[model samples]
Target: MTLTAIGLAIAATFAGWVASLGPLPIGEAREVSTTIVDRHGKLLRAYAMADGRWRLPVHAATEVDPTYLKLLFAYEDHRFRSHAGVDPLALGRAAVQLATRGHIVSGGSTITMQLARLMEPRRQRSIHAKLRQMVRAIEIEHDMTKDQILDLYLTLAPYGGNLEGIRAASIAYFGKEPKRLTLSEAALLVALPQSPENRRLDRYPNAARAARDRVLDRMVEDGVVSDADAAAAKAVSVPKLRKPMPILAPHSSDAAMSSVKNKPVVALTLDAPLQQSLETLAHDRAIALGPNISVAILAVDNASGEVLARVGSPDYFDDRRAGQVDMTRAVRSPGSTLKPFIYGMAFEDGFVHPESLIDDRPIRFGSYAPENFDMTFQGTVPVRKALQMSLNVPAVALLDRVGASRLSSRLKQAGADLVLPKDETPGLAMGLGGVGITLQDLVQLYSGLARLGNVRPLREIESRRGEEREPERLLDQVAAWQVGNVLLGTPPPENGVHNRIAFKTGTSYGYRDAWSIGFDGRMTIGVWVGRPDGAPVPGIAGRTAAAPILFDAFARTGKLPSTLPKPPRGTLIASNAKLPLPLRRYRPLGELVRTDGERAPHIQFPIDGSRIDASGGDGMSAAMPVKVAGGVLPITMLVNGVSVGELDNRRQRLVDSPGPGFARLTVIDAKGAADTVVIRIQ
Candidate 1:
């Protein structure tokens, strides 16, 4: 046969043998550690691969430093961009050196070849392995772009032990990302991957430093770095100890991962800086508050309902504190934290006003008689004061009037999981501390108050978009405003600024749980401090324990407290005497019973001190409603002290709204009983 035909046959045989190796394992190369980041892409936490290796994903164009890439190419494969899997000149030089010295001097492998070796690791080096790597390198170069091949190398290259990739090494050694690296840091990372195990920074500092210096020397020789820069880089010492991977928001990270299984990156709605600060605050405060006590904090954006920071526990590894338990979701007695909702319900029902007088004396319902936290009660106080002080009897009385089941239902409508004791229907005692709730739910409810009655569900994962639902109502706009205004006046803890945040404090029975939930126009934060085992901590009241933390959390948000929403229309801004007769005092249905033959007449509608929409857009006065209760038949009505007309058989009348400005309303019955109210008609 001719020599040309023989050569063609040999080449055909070699191509067939190479094709028998099957497809490259690109799927295996794509596997990476799952990382959880904040909304801004800041790392919150990371989990190792199934094989217990820290191999974080990388993007060559954005994540890696340019200097490191330059140094790496100059030292590892100078002709990397120009070569097709291998350099013939470099291989020829290596062959010549090996023949003269009877030893292997260099591998002459390009970056693509190194990537092939990493993707398909061999237990022992041999001619067969080298041949396989060469074939795989050529296949990879044909299939991938230069940048993609660099990205794969960045992700899969080993540093030492279980840490793979430049990111893992940078975080483990320098506690930072690889976006910006010092000259020495870049050099150290470039060198470690060549002989990762023998030159581990933590295990063999001397070997690691020597390898790093050698890389720097090569950069100097190649004119990639000046001699002066190389000298400074070599002067710096290598890291001697590896840091534990970032575990900032462990509980939040775990939750994100579970929700997004198999995702390479899980992004959440958390703020990393705020989260770290709050975690530090919790940890330091927990230590100071005695042992076995853990603190949980949850902050949410009032407008979007996105969770800004969540410290599930003070320390996630503390066995005594049961820190692994996410206390933010743990159900515990809410104590007085539910008082604001009770007041909100009462306001919504129109039976009470903030200025209405309510008795705070000891009260009973069936077998339950609730008392104040201090066991003493003021005889009578304004409803506003009752809520601001978190008085027990007044709240329970209001709850009784508004039905416990309704309050629970309203809260559930707002997306709060209100857990009543087993088989015990929601009752009056729930107003104080009979029900269980979680810090996360509490924060969500307060966020509703900040949003003026409409609540958006709290969201943690950024990618998990919630389906649009009907707007959840915690209270009507006016009622929610009233509740928030009352809470805004709640006395601040010592050293705390007043009226900056609308907050309520609660201590469960026996001091088992201490909670403080607060909100402003922009955000809401809830704090829980207690034993994870539900064991009581004496003297651990909400005001002293959790309220301070809540205040500190707001301060750490790095912005001024946003003001609450403006009062909506129809809101009654009034004093006790100026309120409508029925609204002047809040009396439970039972206490409202009258034994006298007939009660005096009183105005029931057009709440006093309210702004009446008397505009009469059609150019005439709008008929103002005049409703009367407890009056004899055919009562007389007067507007601005001038007689308007007599009431109908229903004892109700419509009077022309005298004009704009203030007006006096009077109702007089046959028995000479009369009632008066002053209001602004506009």
Candidate 2:
């Protein structure tokens, strides 16, 4: 062989060796951008990858405007389709132009070659780098189709700091996507990547405008756009700074993204328009609420259990209110919010009918005495009237008979997490805001009532095909109907009620928390207003503070409030006279004669305000056995209205030590008759 032939054979062998090393380092070239979209595919939020670059997904010419694509081909590579990887005609013209002008003007790289350079970035400008790019460009042409190459170019081109691709640039600069870019906006995007840092519209508006006009002039010369169109495009103003991306449903987006990790596109169950409007309302209303107060709102589709909108706080960045904390998920006192469930359970158990005459007068269960919100009580009221008034005495009276632990168990079974004081069990006070719960759990409970006691797990993501689920039974259909009917008659807020919606309001002890939750046939909404730091805000009551917002939220949905369904079968809607004798009056054990003719069980020991010494043991509780003289077997002993334990037919029972303090002791028999005594434990 000749010497030149030998040299060509050696070079070919080395080229083959380099090809075996696999493709060039694309360096997150195909990194899918994480996006959170609403049910309608509207963007709610966008997060950059770990590398801090907004590399949004992009497609070929179709993903971009047709006019922009034509201008790109005319200016960047007129013969892009005909070229293998490099355009020889363009290269020859560039070489001639350089020679004639004694300086370089236009580049000879095709779109594919530009993509190759972008994939394997090199800082040094040299002939060797250019040759490497050319070889890689040819390799890419062999591996990918024409459309794929264009997609890479569209996605990998840099626009400014920490931003790449036409989609990112369009959203940041114009507050929109590239699919519907105007003539001037398209020209600006085309010119940006050429000199990203120098022509950044945020920092150098004049330079950006000049670069955009240059592209428009080229478009006119190339006959891609009319002269009049180019002139009009040149006159358009460029954005001075990057506008923020869509940030609706901030908390919901964060939560959904965290749950589904590393996903590029996360479709949530939120309604974009509804979420935006609620967020604005929350912000404006919170500002009016007072300093250091945050508000949270959650709206759910009752039938599907899908969360339509969740505003975690009025302002997520407000440090004063601890706004970063998602109040919907934070544990706080729910106050009278759970009263409806107690009544519903009572109705289900046949303990009381809606028209049953229950005494709302002053009542005491040990030292734990609960009063109405207004510090006064109605002498005697029907069950329906007491519930609508949110009378605390009646709720506690019913909860005592229902067993607080049973109430807690029912809630847990329905997918609610209650946070009680350390080492303290469920008690009568718990029925009156003594326990802790989150707004999310409270909403779930109310949603169950709206679904007629069927509790479906809350859904945050868009439902995928073939997903299976089951609804839990929280209460019987009849019980749920009674509760809904009673709550529907609750007095409306300042704005008169135009539609029927069953709702309940709650105010925690010392005004630390305020809550309002409501539900209709289709949707259920819950609102919370309080300081996230657990600081009390005087005069912040649920009926006045949170209920107003809840009512407005339903109104702002742009649809009239849905009316609840009629009472289901077996629901008793009759007056006291028409109801059965047992259902007409709720008489406790001591209040009525038992079948055996023995006086209903009563406490004969530890008289009211008696002091007893128990210093022989630890500081937690007194070391004395509580004494119960009369009544039925299986009695319950309570300290401060919280159940300590149960007692059998025996007269004396060992009781839990309730450390040194003034504590009230009470005994409840099987018939719900309760006798209380105040004593000092030491």
Candidate 3:
């Protein structure tokens, strides 16, 4: 052999030795590539929070219609398969251009080489880097087969930081999964990896299209496609991208995966539009409440057990992991939120009915004597009246009969953490929402109860690749319906704005927490408004305050079920005039029972203090100031109806005695709905 031949043999041997380790980006590890879709499998958001995680959804290679995949292949890597790793032909041409014409004009690597470089780290690109990449490629070829390598390359290529693969890249660029990729969109994604930072496909479409056509022409010449097919692909129009994915609750829902902690991707049961709208409404409400008031909101899809949205605090992206001490995961006192569940369960278990008789009178639960909102109660009341007024004694009595342990078990089955004491956790107090649970847990549980006892797990995100996991049934379908009927705010005939909602409110022991959870045919929402320390926000009850938040949330979401659960066929109950009615002050709109319909109630009482105005008035704003302004002043300033600091009724502050509760204002609507809390003279 000639000396040059001997040298070539040695070089070849060295090259073969160096081709082992693949080149993946090393310094900054790529962020997880993730895509979030909605219940309908539409992309809602692509989480490419940092620069390292880009996803390219896997559009089935066969599904890549004529012009699409081929066009993309032509634009991205014409000599993709013809070369081993580097395209020697392209290299030779570039070399010729450089030697004869001067400056370096084109890249010398082939698509496979690019894939190898991406799969390994950027640092591995030296001659040794190339050689190692080749070795790994050869090994990969032997193990994975060509199709596997292509799939890996598609999923692992980085578009930028955080976007580690093509699936993510597809979502990031076009806001949809790859299988649904259109020709123009596929063309765009394929053209991105070359200069992911500069030759932006999303922004510079014309340039991307030009590059795509070139790829098609190359594919035609390489025999991967025919001239006519290439022409057809080239002629196909670009696909219009659906709306861009939202950048909502950015990494918050990512935590939903931590609970299971095993999968690469988690598909949450969430309604995208509902989630987005819920968050937006909560955010806007927060904005209206002033930047100082940090608010968190949670909602769910009524039919499907999907957690639509969870905004732990006002800011969606702030310290996603740290933002929540637990991020809507921790359970706290459910306050009145538990009422609806118990009521639903009660209605299901047949302990009470809308017309059942009960004493709303103050009753003692063991030694714990709970007080009604007014610390006074109507003597004998109907089941609905006891619930509406949130009368303590009656609720506890109901819990006593159901047995707290049974209710707790029911809660667990419904997906809330309600641990009962060996003595049954004193749920008479829990009937008032004494049991602690999370806002999400409350919503999820209540949604199930509202769903006629069917609890479907909710999530903050959607999955891109897997089959939609069917929900675990939580409640008896008939039982859930019964519960829903009792909680339904509106009856037939005259459904109000919040006509379809079925809700209940709760206040924890000693004003510690306030919660209102309820749902309708289409959606169920839960709201808890209070301090994190569990301090009582004086005078607030499930019906009065927390319930309003739920009402507001449902009204804002717009996509509620139009039809409601009808009473069982021929399931008629003759009305008894002796039965007492359930009435509360200023009940939130969503919780109002629409009794004006075909089989609706007659003489629907006005929410307490509902203006009997022969002369009409606007009644009162939910934010109207209710204060104690009598000769006897309160000892402190009332915040949300609670006396915090000494009352200051100007110099007119009358030296007062603490008689009964602090003097305060109460607001009730024209209907029987009402809301009242205690306040000091301030």
Candidate 4:
């Protein structure tokens, strides 16, 4: 056969051998480490792969800094683009140098050849190994683009212990991504991969600097960088320690990863900068509040209900404060933070208008009594003023008329997880923090108010592909506007600079929890401060502890406090004189008089025939409390006609169950009007 025919036959045999190997394990070959990123693709946190290597995703020339790519090309392979994965001229030069110098000077392996070795990973150096690499490089070039070959090398290139890829090395050493590498940082990353173990900056700063300077000198010689740039880059100090991978929004990241496992990258709705800022704020505030006290802050986008920032605690590793617990999801007393919803219900019911008169004096509803946050009361204030001041009496009075069960049911319908005490029915105290709720729930509810009464569950992972949840109606548009208007006029932090964001502050009974929830047109934020152990932190009040933080958070976000939308059609924007009769003042509970000249007292608690579990489950016989509403003062109660008790304060009165059995509850007002019901005590 002729020489050309023999060459063709040889090529055909090599092609047959490569084809016999079957398809490449492209997916398994490029397994990258898991990463958690913010909405804008900025790294929030990263986890090592099963092999304990940081093999981060790399996309050839685009995913890396242009300067670093240029330097890498100018130094690693000058004729890389022209070569078909192998350069005969460069190999010949290496041969001559090795023969004359009695040593191997340069390997002459192009980027593709390096990628071939990385794919199979053989440490031995021999003629046989070199030949295998050459064949593999040619095969890789045939099957993949130049960029794909480079991507493989960048993904699998070792960068010291457990660190691989330009992105991983850049983030670990320089504390940044490779997308914006400086000259010095670029040089350091380029030089480390050659002899990663020996020249690790974090382990051997002097060796790493020497290697980096060599690369800088090569860049200057190759005309990739000016002499001045090289000299300046040489002057820059190499990083002596590897930075911990970013752990921003740890709680959110953990939650997301737990929900969706093994994802190469998980993008969340969290804004990285805002998340870090809120975390810092939480840390600083927690320190100021003393040991064991933690601060939880949550900010959400009103339009999408996406949680931009959720700082569960001041520090994730703080054992004393139980920082690992996500307080944003913890069920705790919401204090008067929920009063707006009560008044919101009243507004929706058309029982009171923002400008209408409402009494904030001490009030009672049968056996339940409600008191103002402050011991004093602001009797006969505008409905707006009553809500803005977070008066418990007025809120409970409204709750009495609206019915606690209705309010609770509405909240549940609006996507709030309200935890009531075991076996206790919804009571007037619920209007004053008698129920348990989470900061997240409060944020969602407040976000609804910001969205003009539409409520949706807050979303954490932006990439979640779940079916969209339709927004539920939490309050009528007009009522929502009235609530927002009232809260917008609330006193700002002591700085006296009002953000014009409607907000409310609440201090749980016994100072166990301090909460402040506020929202504007674009965003809503909720803040909570107290000991994580549920212990009372004396002197911790919402206005003093959380409201300032809430305001500061909004300020830090760099978003202006936008006003809510203009009132919808049904909204009344007129003075009390111009308002309709119902909008002029709160109607009395018994305004619809009965024919007997007496307003019958309604048993609010036990709900007529509702079962009451008299056992506390702690080996104690807890008495069942009976409550009444819409009754004249000095109401008398008869249990099985024995006259169990008589009390003036509408506070809950505990009555002995006489063991679990059916019992009769009767309430009579001084007017001789009576109401009766029977219930079973379990």
Which model scores highest in TM-score?
1
| Cα lDDT tens digits for candidate 2, 614-648 | 76645444457777766666676766545566776
Best by lDDT: 1
Answer with 2 or 4, whichever has the higher TM-score. Answer: 4
Location of the lowest summed lDDT over 10 successive residues in candidate 4:
667-676
TM per candidate: 0.88, 0.83, 0.60, 0.84
Error of 1 at 2 (Å): 1.6
lDDT of 1 by residue, 364-464 (tens): 68888888899898999999999988899999998887679878988998998988878899888888889888998888889999999998898889887
Candidate 3 lDDT over residue span 538-579, tens digit each: 665545545556677777676655455666442324343532
Estimate candidate 1's RMSD in Å.
7.1
Residue 96 of model 1, lDDT score: 93
Q: What local lDDT does model 2 show for residue 503?
A: 93
For candidate 4, lDDT tens digit of each residue in 522-630?
Answer: 9999999998899999999999999999999988998678878998985668888776443577755654455767556788788867888788767677877877776
RMSD (Cα, Å) of candidate 3?
18.5
At residue 233, candidate 2 shows an lDDT of 91
lDDT of each: 0.87, 0.84, 0.54, 0.84
Superposed by TM-score, candidate 3 places the C-alpha of residue 522 at a distance from the truth, in angstroms, of 3.9
